[model samples]
Target: MATSYDYVIVGAGSAGCVLANRLSSDPGVRVLLIEAGGRDNHLIVQMPAAAPIAARDPRLDWAYVTEPEVFCENRHIIEHRGKVLGGSSSINGMVANRGNPRDYDAWAAEGLPTWSFAHCLPYFKKMETFVGGANEWRGGDGPQSIERCPATHPLYRAFLEAGVEAGYERTEDQNGARHEGFHIAQSFTRKGRRCSSAAAYLHPVSHRANLTVLSRTLTRRIVFDGRRAVGVEAQTGGTISTYEASREVILSAGAINSPQLLLLSGVGSAAQLRSHDIAVVADLPAVGRHLEDHQIVPIQYSTPEGLSLSHRLKGLRRYGIGLRWLLFKSGLGASTMCEAGCFFRSSDRADYADIQHEFYPLTAEMGDPEANFDDGFMFSMGLMRPESRGHVTLKSADPSEHPAIVFNYFAAERDRRIMIDGMRRTREMAAQRAFDGLRRAEIAPGPDIQSDDEIMAWLRSAASTEYHPCSSCRMGVGEDSVTDGEGRVHETEGLRVVDASIMPHNVTANLNAPVVMLAEKLADAIRGKTPLPPSGLVPH
Candidate 1:
């Protein structure tokens, strides 16, 4: 690696990898992409059913346990994040969801100009290469290959039929004109491997002479010149050192680490920074505040008889499946367990209803739900439009110290009320007569658990994260905003943040696609080239 580069990106996660690829395309610009872990070329990291095992395996994961919560099953929940070259995308269920169109509109409504669905859709199309082929809505030739999940599991098919029988309409494309009702989920799988950001953006370009890819490096903090971010200090190969950005320092770290890095670098609230003896650099109060995450309360039920991956774990059978995955890359090892999912509204939902009902066809046994699974389908229902807010605060000035995360989940009465309605709605759909042929019995909250109080009790005892945490470093038009709509950190000349942390609010679905889209747009902005918008509209 050179002593300096045009762009020094921290954390080779979803967004970072994309930025590294897009920004380095200039050939003239030298880019440095640093990661905290090694390559994402592992077999477990590519296969889908292996995601659970990969999530639990500390060698490839940063298994973070949440602070004790008042409503989370009355215990601290364990959260898993990938620490490899592709970050969470290396270990996450490879669902390629862009959330609802209304999600981006909400950001525009919050004074972030150019963030509307109409504005960002081009970036989405630019980064994707949909396997089913694209029309006007889907992108045909892009980097990420999005395809429909194979019709392998019988229970997933049953779930779709049940939704249709329960008075719901069939939506062909969730990322198209509308995002509602039941449908088979699209995934980021090219052939049999997960098309993570690294695979899609980094792997092909790893040989670029102008680009330097460093692994097993832990960034301690952003080194600053006055209030401007000049570079970063990190530990590589157990040796402490610093890397200069020369032109710009972008923090593409995920929501958790982005905020933690800001706080550790004395770029947060004056009061909080001073408490830890940190000399304040920039008093950005919203640096670690306004944290939001999607909470899922699973509704499980047994299937009478179907190929549900439940019996596959018995004795030598699982090993056989593993052998097939390692050799042929087919069978249960090729894709994620959730073959199909739906987005529907509570009967009384008002403004938008597409932010609920994300079902998965599996059940687990531990704190991180993926770690403990036996057999059954689970419908994870919650308020996709949560009003609750939380934050990531420093425990001390030490970068290695665990940050204090107060999710304050279900703290708002509105959050609780919406979740209660959401649960009722899911159960109502699951009880449809179409499922009568496939489903055996309700395993959780059961047929006897009926009442708002009962549902809330179950939520308080069972709710967990959907693994989408964002908006800790929110973008806005006001002074309180951490970055501008273009992702430029306000007042910082060369620094920018192109990750989920820049999202003003949580998208109504999975966030990986949107994060990649942000990087694509930011690349255009940095290169001073205006790519064609989805509708061919030019700014006045």
Candidate 2:
């Protein structure tokens, strides 16, 4: 007989891990969590500094590449999605940013009243235990642990000081009442170890008898009776199996996979499904539309010698740092390299920050080992809210085939203008007196690329994703929306999406923290628990 579960969550990613822990807490409920990849127990995942390595590790990352993008000079950008137990949370840079509250208010205005910043704030607090103590804006005790980066390095300090010197405000906590300024980053780390969702939520509850976590299980399709999803057909190792979901089958498979799964199960555009020779169940045209991501162009500089993390990569020192982290979980290995960042408006006309910046202490050619060096620092300027839209479509009917993704970045004239302004602003920050002694020369876009046209040309060739993708199965009120306000598929029962895909639009910051909060909010709705009372704090 097929194993029966009260809840079956596909894709043990950020949202799936949280759902497994929260839903199975009742003891009476049986929860099955399926992951396409294996456990996240490797040291590369445990150490915060090893995130970049984990992102490229085939065993840990799906490493999906995009289709050629016209706005990006027809180049295919590599998109890394974590395949391990904790999903992208295990492989990401660990920056825990909640984004601007207004971003959520904008969602509320778009017909998702329950998702406003006022309503979602409590859930954000419910999922995190911030190290700086709790306040009206921060959470105190929660499953996920977060620590503020010390920004102790002179380079980090210079970066923050330079932001202020450039006339930007200095916010103590970006996740607090105000986020429009320069601030030290907060990370998903505790005691110097990466606190991935698997580590924080799933690992702690794995002993629960009613909870079953199936690693290396690839969900092929949703098994539906009539129009209601009743179970999932999946493949484990060399065998194909069916698992019954007595109550609900939540698709927390993320932005790319969730919509793909829905489309593959005969739930997408009628014409598209017919092309693949699949019978249509629900013809939702927006299943894979509205794809959004933060596009970033890096600004690297060859800093004065010995100022970056380059020295740590040298011969014996590399092994020594590894030993220190493996033994005491300290030293350079304990940090996520990206220690400081800022959010600011690109122009005076904007009411809030539309540009975000990240500072990296070490500089190395990501994939080219021969170009790896030890004495440079870099920062990336990312547009917070891009107007350009994109889509994700099935490459074929095969579930094993990755979807074709195209993020038409810079397609909107406003987007291009903002990016250009962002580049100019980044140059201003780097030129600040705070970096006067350390700054050597600009490595990317060089000093020669000065005009607006030159910067636009450079961006078309060099811009890349910040790796935050969402809104493929966007939640809204119309026919174009795949899911409703609470994540229920508009015309389907017994199915829901509880990941970044449900975001009506991408938030102003990193997607990880918001994704986790989405799961927490949805779990309450599923359990029939009363919604937490809004704190009534006005949105900033």
Candidate 3:
């Protein structure tokens, strides 16, 4: 006999964890949360500094590689999505950024009024306990614990000073009154440990009698009864089984898998469904359209011998740092290393900051585990909102097969121009007098590559993702949208997509925080609660 639940949430990820907690809060309702990956109790996941290692681990990450991009020198980019519980939040560089207020206003302009920054600000406040204390913008008491990066390292101080010297303002809080200028980054951590959605929402409520969490279970497809989603068919320990949802089936499987699951379940374009030999369910051509991601290129420079964090990752120092963290949860392992960053416009033509940059005190070659630098610093900058769009489609009918993702980075001439400006701005900031003592020679794109054509060519070969992918299953107020403003799948009942995939567009920052906020807002909508009143606070 198939088990029954009031709500069956696929993918115990950032969004699913929150949804499971919220929906199961009612003692009368039974909730089932299923995850494709194993428990997130590993040391690498708990330590904020181990993010890079966790991102590369197949056991922790989906590690999906995009299809060759026509614009990005026809190279396949690695797209890492968390397979474990808490999803990308567990493996991500825990930067807690809410993005610019206008980002959501753009969504509202797309016919999603409830998604306007004003309407969504209250939910963003509701989901986080900011160390900076409560205000009109920041939340004081919430599930997710947020910490402001100490920004103690001399290199971090230099970066902030350089930003100011290069004509950028310095704000105390990026997620507070203003999201512009340079500031110390906020992190999703508490007392040194990672504060993932699992840690914040699910783990605390796991003992609730109404909630049942199934880890290491792969959801094959949604089990639909006619047009309504009834439940899901899944595999656990090689055994196939069906779990019925009496009320709703929510897909929180990040950007890539959510659309892939929908396509596999026969809810995508009729032509594509027929080609895959699957009977069409809804014939929604927009199921996997409008894919958006943040494309980043690193501007790296050599630093003084002992100034970079990479110097400490060798021999006895590495072991000592690990031992300290294990013993007291303090030291290098306590921080994600991305302690400071800047948000600024590439040109006056952009309304808000079109370029987002984060600085790392150490550098390593991409895909090279052993190429740790003894002296290096890097700034990774990406166009906050790109004109380029891509799509996610099924490669085959097999549920286990990965989907084909094509993030056509630099497809738009405007996107390429903005990236070029961002690179120039990064170089300008690095050349400031603040870094005169610590700065060394350029590493990644050496000083030799000066011309526009040369820079564009270099970007095509070097640009990669900032790991913020969204909008493949976007929410809007039109026939082209897959989900409604409230995240309900169009032309469908008892089903919704409540992850980053539902974002109308990509936010102007790292996605983990915004995805969590999205889940918080949608959970209230799903529960039919009174909508939180819009804060009406605008950034200065």
Candidate 4:
């Protein structure tokens, strides 16, 4: 492998894969994509239903647990980052969400006009080939193929119907015009297989002579010469290799690792760097200051035994599901059982939909085959725009050691208030007459937990991450930001961040789509391509 390239992108994640594909398109320039984990060829990664299995397997998942969260009863919440080529996008629930348009418009309101909904729609369209076909708002032809969930299960129908009965409209396309309603899920799937970022972007262009992908190579730190990033020190099979980049070094290691990398490279607070006996490269105090993530509290309801999908997992039927998927890629195994969900406001005073919901057919932790669970469905509800902030700090000077992540969830009063309201809103939707026959007793946070105080207490123990962490290395106009609107590190040259880590704040939906969109847009700027004109289409 060549020891130097024009562009060296760390972490072959959702963002990095896109960068590798787009940047390598110019044969004149060479690109090297480094992945800390091995290849994402496991059956657990290909089959969509095996998402949970892939998330906890040490071979594929980082399985980084956070520092005990004080807001959630001091529970050490699990943070499952995909250790494979596609990163979290490989193991995450394949929900293809772009969040609300207002999310980007708000970014524009913050003085980064290029990130407004109008400016971002083109890139969102550029990265995705919506299975439903394209329009003014949705993209027609793109790399990532997105398909809508069939949501044919009786229970799925009931949940969606319940939302309508609770006075919400059934939205056909959540990613289009308006998203504030109950909708069938859009999955990052091609045919029946999971269309991971690696599968969609990197694998398709593997034959490119200019592109070199190095797997199982853990990047130690950025090698900088007087504030300009030159390359990175990486370890491959106990062999330390240095790869120099003549153009730029991009860090797409997601929210946690990116911040951790910055801190380890002496690019964070000078005091913090000195504590680890590391020399300061730049005193960017905000490197890991605005850690944000969505915390969902599950509201589970027991369904009749035969009505639940959990019943099929008992014996031979379970094996059949796997066999069917392996043979023809059709069946329940072809999809991440998370079919139905919605985006809605907690109350009238709220801005665009402030809360989000995702319904899963089974409540069991599929990761543990030995652990038994009841036959039930759960609605994981969370605040779309969470205000709570936290930080990612190095545990030690050791490069191999995982960073200490603290979500500080619900630290903001508004976050706490919205969560309780969102929980109540979830209950109201579930209680609709549509669920009368299919749904049985309330399984979790039962009838007794009705009052605000009871719900608040229950939330302290129940709420956990939705696996969408962002904003540890935010891009903005102010000093609080680590990067600029162009994704270049504030004071550092030739170093850029193009992932969810650079989000000014977390988007209103899942991070994968937003991260991919971020890369697609920034890749143009990096190549000196003129920015796409902002769209004028208005959301209804």
CA lDDT of every candidate: 0.80, 0.90, 0.90, 0.89
Q: List runs of model 4 lying over 4 Å from the truth.
A: 365-373
Query: Once superposed on the true structure, which residue ranges of model 2 sit more than 4 Å away at CA?
Result: 365-374
Write model 1 residue lDDT over 1-540, tens digit each, in one string. 576888899989999999899889989999999888888878788887788787778778877777877655547777777789998888887877887887887888988668888888888888999877877678998988888887557677777888888887777878776687787889888887788999999989988899998899988998899878888898887698888988898888888888898888878898999999998988888898888888877788876544446677667898988888889988877867777888877665556663466566666643454566767777767567677887888998887777877676888888888888777778878888767766778988788888999888888888878778888899998865788887877655677888888899887778788888888888888778986565543221
Task: Write down the TM-score of every candidate.
Answer: 0.96, 0.98, 0.98, 0.98
Model 2, 102-217: lDDT tens per residue? 99999999999999898999999999999999889888999999999888999999999999899989998899888889999999999989999999899999999999999998
Model 3 lDDT per residue over 52-120, tens place: 888888899887888999998798888888999899989988998999999989999988888888988
lDDT of 4 by residue, 177-236 (tens): 877799999999998999999999999999999999999999999999999999999999
Worst 10 residues of 1 by lDDT: 531-540
The runs of at least 3 residues in candidate 3 whose Cα sits more than 4 Å from the true structure, single-residue gaps closed, are 366-374
Superposed by TM-score, candidate 1 places the C-alpha of residue 414 at a distance from the truth, in angstroms, of 1.7
TM-score of 4: 0.98
lDDT of 4 at 39: 91
Stretches of candidate 1 off by over 4 Å are 305-307, 534-540
Candidate 3 global lDDT: 0.90
Report RMSD (Å) for each prediction in the order shown: 2.4, 1.4, 1.3, 1.4
